[model samples]
Target: MAGTGGVSPSQTPTLPTQPGAMTPGRIGCAEIVRDLAWEHTPLGPRDRWDPAVTATVELVLTSPMPMAFCFGDRFVLIYNDAYADLIGTLHPAAMGRPAADSFGELWRSPGIGGVVEDVFRSGQPFLEPETQLTVVRAEGTRPEQAFFTRGHSLVRDSHGTIAGVLTVAAETTQVTRRLQNLSELTSRLAAALTVDDVARVVLGYAMASFDVDLCMFAVDDGNGFRAVRRIRGEMLDEADERLPPVWKRLSDDPHAPLVASARANRPSFVPDGEPLRAVASDRHERRIRALAVLPLRTASLKGSLSIGYRAAHTWLPAERALLNAAAQLVAQAAERARRFEAQHGTAQLLQRSMLPEHLPELERFRIAARYDVGVDGNAAGGDFYDAFRLADGRLAMVLGDVAGHDVRAAAVMGQVRAALRALALTEPDPPGVLAGLDRLVTSLGAESRNEEIFVTVVYGVLDPADGTITLASAGHPPPVLRRAGLGGEPPTAELVKVPPGAPLGLGGRWQTGLVRLEPGDSILMFSDGVVERRGRALNDGLDALVAVAAGASSGDPRNLCSLATTAVPGPTDDDVAVLAVERAVALSRSATMLVAAEPTGPSRVRQWMTTWLREWTVPEPVISSAILCTSELTTNALLHAGTPAQVHIDLNAVRLLVSVADTGTRGSVIRAHTDTMSSRGRGLGLIEELSDSWGTDPSVRGSTVWFELLLRSTSD
Candidate 1:
């Protein structure tokens, strides 16, 4: 019989009935049983250890947990079921093998053997909380998946001491991916705006939402849905329009079930199908093997939202609800932009009607004008210009810009322009005109009950006789002028700055200044839009306009006006209006002076008119038709030309020519007639037939026939 503490050197090998059981004659039985099993064994089959204990131990040896035993200094290990499975049926042969003998590779692992030895020597249960290890097979196969986990001690000896280690763990490969998917979905939802943006976000969310291979979003019109967003990994390629139908499919036939389902605002599911499977056969290129479409409806617009997966996928009710919520947010933003566009159309119509049609003709100046509205939809700006004849024979020209860009500003602009025109006609001078304009503005403010609005303007009255213009500026940019010269080219347009005054409705005394408009000088009045552009400073925009006007041709008023407006390339970002005035050129030397003439015979009138031209420095043959036209005019003066029978010629150094004028009271009129043989009325009619331009003023004593002919300077 073997003693509990140490088997007595038994002559005959007699096995004890129970190893750790208390028997009367057992040696060290109480101590051995107390330390090993921790309980005394009874004298029955229930208390006694079973004969199958060795086999059970052998079964436990093949478990996945590492199993080993240490008695004194020796280490004995039996590979567990998982380890034996790794070795594949060689486990029984590996029974009782030492750690060094069976797993020579594990023995060479840095510090592992030493850790086990320290556990054995120290008698303290050893634990390895975490470790990283590499396993190399003697057969030189490729490395297997590495593992990370912890191991603890198992004690099995008479004395309490560390005898073995056991460990249990789980792999983290799948869990890491779940966290990444969650992180990606959170990032995309933060900044989505448009339908396209939502679709892109949905593509990323759906792919990561269920951890699928790929995801796509498609939008549908009435018929069928087309893929608008397709994502695979991190790359997003813009959709190609030139691809074949199979490449980007949307069923053309309206009768298709998918199309009908989407049009009805119902979710349609497309699983493995007869045609769909064939169409989506390619795994990498195709977006998904399964699809779901939801119709999006908000107000008048209708579209579809689609979600798909490359793998055979099934979506939960929760997933469908999440997608539907995201779709609604996307639809709301799109509808807002649409409403903004519709309102902008109405505002533009009102803005266009408020602007003036034409500029009134000043006495000795040629005026050109243009007005351009902005293209920024629905929002109207307050920019206006008007030129019209005043009651006092002076031409009143007004240009202004309201402070804001809105329909209200446009309405205010119209009221201001109309009131200014009326007031300018009634007011005595520029200051009085502005003072009346201020009262109108204050009255408008009171009518609208709006306190946060104001306007800037430049008002002027041009007297072409002296070629002097009186003007006042109220918080407006100064006009520019390009003066003409006889021998030299036109000088750079000078900026005609005025002292800033309070804007309209802000009570302040306004001062007026007079500008001398020499014969060929050009005057430009414009709103701030021409000199304040986006990405450019006010000074830079002004400088650029000056340069443009320097090179621009002062031709027809309409063309010059167009050039000035186009000179500042927009999007001006604001409304623009410009008015230009230049002196008209003279026709001939005699037309530059006011003279007297009387009719006697055809030769005498011609010679008198000819000698008058000579005195005015006119060459002989140069006045050929002019001479005949003068004879006709003199005959008409004696016959029909009314009181103050004098010819007035206006020298327009701007166009380098003259305009002829006369004052005729009554009974003198020029009518268009094709008959050439008429005698008694031929004189006045003949003047009209030969001149470049001719007109009559019945309100004055006589009328004037103005013709434009080339004036050759002596230097030329």
Candidate 2:
């Protein structure tokens, strides 16, 4: 007989019995037990078995919980239907076998066989709150981790001796895995900064965690709800894939699951396809059999998240709780993003409104400017660029930066810009204009009683008649000059050596440096942001700018401005402002003709071009090609622009440039393949094939399409 030490008395089983009550059921594990040849095993025939063993077997077979009873010293197994399911494929055959034979190495593992042996020998009752086991759930699959809480109780025979041990188990694998996934989700959501980033994280987690076929994230966009949907299978067509993710809009329809869930501020689940099919308006939605919609309710944002399955499923309580928790995280992130975007938009709008809306359009020179905020665009920086005509008809351009990133800095910039323009109206020289700004900044600092007001500016004035530009600096970076090559020499770029004065507000002397620009020459002025990288030296950034500007193929002011802004490789911590002015080629002779909007426009332009070229003693080959290119441009302007076109021709010693300008809203010219049969789209192709160089310049009102033909070599 086994002693009852090292066991809890409460966990002992009550083995009640009735005489001759060993009737086996017709179905389930009971029938399998009655049919097994027990005479081959240690327990012998069923009729010969002890009454206690029979009673325990009956209890194990009838109980709903997963229970198995080990009888005698060999620990032969007798389990119910639920226990058979717990062991997966080791059923029927494992019914009457020893526990070691059925569980194999698992039975010999620590705490499993030892606990059963202890309970059987000592009559002790043991309980394990949670135990992890590697189990092969199917016949030919690898083992996977399973968690369970199991209890073992001793069973006694009719002679009042412990005969076997009975065990019960409850699996907790699903709950354990879900909690771990939730923890990981929380960590990932913490790093999400933007609304789109949050959506991507949430959608990926839901799809992987729930093993769903489809997931969608929808946000309320004032007018309606915009949704970003992802599917696991090839349910969407190629055309749908090309469209943006926010293409679908869910209105305030009560029938829509997302809208209804958001309106009621709760989650909605449908286990069967019939209910979903009745309200399904999209073909994609009709294919789903199960769906769960979780509403995201936040102070500033209203949205909903949904998961779908192609097979019917029951929405378990644990799954629902996890989904709701994920939605809460998403809502919080979205609210934060919404607030940040709102502030960023307001700051950008304020800064842009204070800057000049348009640059003065000069006839002999072209001007272009660009401004970019820092990578972290949460605040408005004090970087500004302006180009205006002075009272003496000289173009005045300034690029400056104040030392702050706030509304106050922007306000001060606006003041400095306005004061510079007012002073330039009277004092057109670059040095005088900067001197007046220095005093204004000093006065501004004194009025505010703050000595932190710092400003750096590089002001310039361009005289179009002599192509001379005068530049002055107030502790700002020197301007770059891209001098066009003459007589077969390549263009060269260098930083202007202007005397650096103390920054404004400190009161220092300012001096000017003058440079004469030739035809196709350009001067670029920029704030320090353009030449200041986060970790690199300022000289290195300056050298990189010179290289990029010199290597640029086009001398167009807009192109140069764009190249200067992107001269640095990495992100910049400050705002950038670049202003570029290019001196047009000196024309020996120029002619302009405003062609009518009639069908005879191309013919008339061709006749005008040929007559002018002939009178100028131009070669017949040049005249023929120019006439053909001009006719193509004129026809395109009329066909596409649907407006009158101005044909302008400029003749220099080296090249002849002809341009067709229109007042229409067509802002770009697209080149197409030259098809002889096509009448309308082959104009640009002819220009490209016939001219030595061709380009287009898009402006505020219209576009200029021009082509240049080299009449003589640079040696001429």
Candidate 3:
């Protein structure tokens, strides 16, 4: 009889009973099998074994492949040396034992156990292209996952009776690991929302997955393709490592591999550097031996992705497929980002056109406004702010938010803002203005077939004469007030308790709240985005805004607006608009002069101030003191600060205030002692003696020195 591989049964060798009794030439597991005592095994002594069984065992042990034979009913395990290495620590002792006892959990696994049983029962050969199993490769260590392609065939005895099953396995763990990495790349590409984002994800995946020496991504840049290349060991040239890789503009060489691939919408592979060196455009490309250029094709985008290795590499079919799939994913993401960018640009342009280009300037009140879009800059939000002069000389300020983040919402906001201005011209009162806006919004909603058009607005009118702001809210957050301290008290900030009414499109009555603002007091009105943060309560955000506003050192409306807009940390998910108005001290007259840095600057300022004060009629003594103080301040600013200064003079009912501000590195104002007799330092001395109150206000860049004189009752 002949065994499975044609070895004759008559050729079977006798088994050895004593150790080292086998042929000295046998190596590996062959030596171990020959020296084993077979009497204790299920098959009994080797001398009593069937001739066919002995022949099959000899064939398995002599083979170089990882092969195993399970004999008899218990399926006693017998394997070659290659099989011993495959099972790691489970070998040696596993010899002469049942297959189930040797493999442990691996033998009981669904794929392995069921297939082995089927092959044994049907006497058929079966093959599994790939199957996953977990095994302990070392003693006292955790089991690790492994993948393999296995083939199982039934073995026949000498009388042609079906016996046990034989198995052959080839590990495929490396290929399976690469496929897993490709799956991860697919997931990351789906989340990319911008062109630059897609490039970063693709290049990073190529570098990590392929271990390539160079990775490059190119995108259509109107005139040509612009490429961002990442090279190993080149990170030191980047100032910020967190930023995306450096970019280069490719020349208009159609012969270059990347350009050719993109133009033809195909992929090109170079297995050696000889061909690449002829068309190489740069030093990096010149040294690369293996390269792959894959075109990224999309309806709105034209680009290419390329990877290179320093040593020659054969591009396998599987690797080519994976690279092509990556390119397709990148192209889809790039298309989406292109569309978003186009829409976002148009929407933002439209939104800005609806807002006031410049705020109306008021003598007694300074106004400033700020606007910022949300983190998802793909859509246009509804927050808006404006300041315009009313017919009655009162300043009208409004900040409102429409409900949605689309073109329709932006259009409605424009309509509301234009209507607000018209209404304020006719009905200047806060309540009346809001009532008219409510009617307008309700009518708009009805026109849209009641699609739930929601809007919230806070409107205020400032009476410059009395320094009072009448405010009205329609389902909006209350305005915050930073009250200027009086009588040596620190400034305080608090939210105005305005009555909240129903939002627009819902019929409700609105009431006006009046808050009297003292000189230097500022009021801030903003959309809800200024006081709302993710993962935090609304009240906590509101309190944080109050703290930021109060902590500001200056009452300038511009500074307050800046601080309030940045009150919330991290990215904001909604639009923010802040409008700030500050009431200056009651001034009958004010004039400002830009003092030159030359020596003649102080004299010119003196002449200007003297002429202006005298023109107001009969203030000779006050005029002399004001001119002398002004000259001294201007001189000090030019000599010590080494910069031009601004001289501002304000005349009010009770006093005259003169301030000199300079933009320089110096942050403090010099104050000379009262008893100092040196002429060089007598400037501050004269200012101290002549003025009623003198002080210095330090700023971020420089300082402001000012002196006030209490006017006699006749000066006005």
Top model number, TM-score: 2
The digit string of per-residue lDDT tens for model 2 on 552-634 reads 75566766776787788888888888889888875457799999889999999999998898888776777888999999889
With candidate 3 superimposed using the best TM-score fit, by how many Å does residue 167's alpha carbon deviate from the native? 26
| lDDT at residue 713 of model 3 (Cα atoms) | 33
Residue-level lDDT tens digits of model 3 in 1-716: 00112113342211111122223564578777788888888878888876446645765675444678787777888887767756665667789888788767656544655667777887667655554545455445554554566666666654456657776665553443443444344445555656666777787788778889888888888878888877766433111222333457787688777777888898999888644576676787788989999999888788899999989999987578667766776777678777866876676667777888668978788787777667566677788898999888888989999988888888899999999999999888888888898999989988889758989999998898898888889999999999878985888999998888888767788988899889978999988888888898999888988887787655566667667867878667888888899887664587899998899999999989987777766367787888899898898787767789999887755567788988763434544454534323567778878876666644434557787776763344
Sorted by lDDT (best first), the order is 2, 3, 1
List model 1 lDDT by residue over 1-716, tens digit each.
Answer: 00111112222122111122223673331232223331222211223433122222332342233233322244444333334333322333334445555445544444445555566566454333233433333233543333433232333311222334322221332322322232223223323323444555555555655555544444544444555444455432222111111114566555433344446777666654322443443555354566666666677655565555565666555345445544554444334434544574466557666765434645557775655556444477898887888787878887898878887788889889888877777774877877777888888888889876788898888886787888898878888777665576655676876666788888767898778777667788888877777887788777877777666544334334555665666567777778888765543222333445443344554565566656666555446757666656555554434333454332323222223335542222434543443344455455556544344322212334434333443235
Reference-based TM-score, model 3: 0.56
Instruction: Kindly report the root-mean-square deviation of model 2 from the true structure over all alpha carbons.
Output: 20.1
- Comparing candidate 2 with candidate 3, which one achieves the higher lDDT? 2
The best candidate in terms of lDDT: 2
Candidate 1 vs 2: which has more lDDT: 2
* CA RMSD per model (angstroms): 31.1, 20.1, 21.6
